[model samples]
Target: MSFVHFSVLKDECLQFLTENAPSNSYFADLTFGGGGHSFAIMDLDESYKLVGVDQDPDALKNGAKLIAEKQLGERVELLSSNFSKFPKLIKEKDPEIEFQGILMDLGVSSHQFDIPERGFSFKYDAPLDMRMNYEDDTIETAADICNTRDADELEEIFKTYGEERFARRIAEKIVEERPIASTKDLENIIFHCYPRNMRFGKIHPATRCFQALRIAVNEELGVLTEVLPQLVELLKTGGRLVVISFHSLEDRIVKRAFKELGGKDSPFRILTKKPVTPSKNEIAANSRSRSAKLRVIERI
Candidate 1:
């Protein structure tokens, strides 16, 4: 399978990262999907070096191939690990490695959703296995979550992560229909949970429910909360951290974290008071880029 991820807000990320970076600076691409941003950053300067990290095995394999094909072998180093553990990984790889810039593009990649077996999209009829790192046995699959979690927990996930208005109703329905075998099964439950009139809205009825399940299974918010501070610490003075989040929950976390860390007496400064979103042209080109919100902070 071809790893085809359109890096959201690509140029904006590069602008922020490279603007204040010194010559020969080192950077990290924490979610190195398709090696898109990593290669773009490397193209900016021959002296610069990048460490590309991704938890997905497919991404790691494709990234290695991309690096080799681009002849970026000497400049880009690809690591197969979750971005949450990036701090420890960097420490072991190079004790003195402090980044001039770090980037995180959160949410599922296009490749993941397009693959039927990944079960990220309702459009596919695959098993409910929405693990970002499917190889990790410890993390529960989406089906496991639906089948095992209580109604209250499911409601909380839908409300907090997905922000679905009818969270309680949806959760109750899911619990009532236990052993959801496939994406279609879950989709049907959510679709019926919506009112007949509201079911034919601009978005699919299953969108929020699926998003909630994926978030819960991955523990995305908790991981992001833990990793944000570490990224700031990994930066050198004047270094920048650029995060692009696709949903409101993620943007809120990034916003709050930046505010907390960018205050007086703190070592960081928020660069964007409001998040930067994708332009009309980018959105037209890749519709998936539409919901992207980018925030940047610099170590002062």
Candidate 2:
């Protein structure tokens, strides 16, 4: 399948990032999944340049192709590092470099969930490999965690990352059914772990556990927390840092970090007192965007 990702809140993000922008400024899209947001920034103005970064090899490859096809090779520079390492990587390239606007659209990209072999969704019966950077052998796959971790540890991961109510039961059942090598295997275990009556709810029983495992496998929350302050520091004065988080945990972290960074004595100010959610029309058009929440902060 082609790399297709519907850029969530494109208008809102662009408004916050580019409105009243400085001349000849640079913008960074830290999670350049499909180059949707990155290319949008460049198309908005010829004077604006973009630095697109992503860890996923597939995304990086697709971004390069898109950049070339759009004749934006000169205006857009695509990097292959994870967003967490973006600060250090960009610093090494040019110590004085700072961005006019920086954006982070957190959570798994639509392409990741759609690819069966990538193992991001319960809908697929593929291997339980949930590493965002599939090339990074150092990161443990979801199968490894399911097959190895103790029930208690697994429970903690599901409970803390997924907010799963049946985490304990599911974790215990997973230990009983060790060697869960595939997504369907893990999904079945989680399904049976739930009460029979509750299994047919609107949301699948395996949703939370799958989400938890993906977050755990990728260390999404920790990376986000670690990178927020660095991104703030990399912002130019009057520049903005905009983030769109899909889950509550991610939103909480972004909210807290923005508050701390935008404190009275700080060199930043919170732009969105409350998060901005998608419009009714937007959610109707793209169901995946329903849960997204956007927040922005500007360096003073």
- Candidate 2 TM-score to native: 0.99
Per-residue alpha-carbon lDDT of model 1 for 1-300, expressed as tens digits?
688888899899999999988889999999998888988999999999999988988999999988888898999998888788989978997888899999999988999989999999999899999998999999899999889989999999899888899999989999999889899999999999999999989999899889988998888999999999888989999999999999988999999999999999988999999999999999999999999999999998
Candidate 1: give the clashing pairs: none
Model 2 error, position 274 (Å): 0.6
Scored by CA lDDT, what does every candidate get?
A: 0.92, 0.93
Q: For model 2, how does the per-residue alpha-carbon lDDT over 156-182 read when each residue is reduced to its tens digit? A: 999999899999999999999898999
Off by over 4 Å in 1: none
How many steric overlaps does candidate 2 have? 0
Runs off by more than 4 Å, candidate 2:
none
